[model samples]
Target: MNPGLHPSKVTAQFEPLIAAFPDWHWEIRNLTIEGDYLALHLRVTGTHRGTFQGVEPTGCRVTTSQFTLYHLVDGKFADVWDLVDTNSVIEQIEQGKAVL
Candidate 1:
């Protein structure tokens, strides 16, 4: 639930992430809504233009896929869970695996 990846939960925590990836974009490829549960398939694209998780900027472009599930309560978001393919993104930035 921490948007900025901080251990502590805080609102607007994604500000640092926005600074780190100024051009970051999360595109939803698929979505399914059933009752109070919503599922999202996404592709996240960005450039490592600033520091993240203490890792210095690499200026590398990264693309990663993720699946997220959100629980709704009274038409508002209550809880969220995500499954991201972080290894693929790391390989792109560090090992030059994918060519996108």
Candidate 2:
């Protein structure tokens, strides 16, 4: 789904996840910039405390990694691409791993 340039649409995509992971935190692991392009590596952690996509809270401490690339034009973001390790999140919830 393309969230496009609309702020509400962009917020909609994460509203549920945010509600589900109220204590979520994103830690930037690495960042690199060259000209108009930028890349980032991050570690995200949170506790499952609310429903996400109909999946009930597992009360598990979830940790996942993500990578993102951005292209800027005139100092404004022109494009963005990302990769998130969602499998790790699913696995932790499915495996019944409790708080860390």
Candidate closest to the true structure, highest TM-score: 2
Instruction: Give the least accurate 10-residue stretch of model 2, judged by summed lDDT.
Output: 1-10
Q: Write candidate 1's Cα lDDT for 1-100 as tens digits.
A: 4223323443375688678879989999999999989999999998978877666778888888889998877766777788978677666767533455
Most accurate candidate by lDDT: 2
Candidate 2's residue-wise lDDT over 1-100, tens digit each?
2323356656897787789999988899999999978999999999988876566888988988989898877666667888988777777777768322
All models, RMSD in angstroms: 4.7, 3.3
- State the RMSD for candidate 1: 4.7
lDDT of each: 0.77, 0.80
Which 10-residue window of candidate 1 scores lowest in summed lDDT?
Answer: 2-11
Off by over 4 Å in 2: 1-6, 98-100
TM-score of each: 0.76, 0.83
lDDT of 2: 0.80
Candidate 1, which segments miss by more than 4 Å at Cα? 1-11, 96-100
- The local distance difference test score of model 1 is 0.77
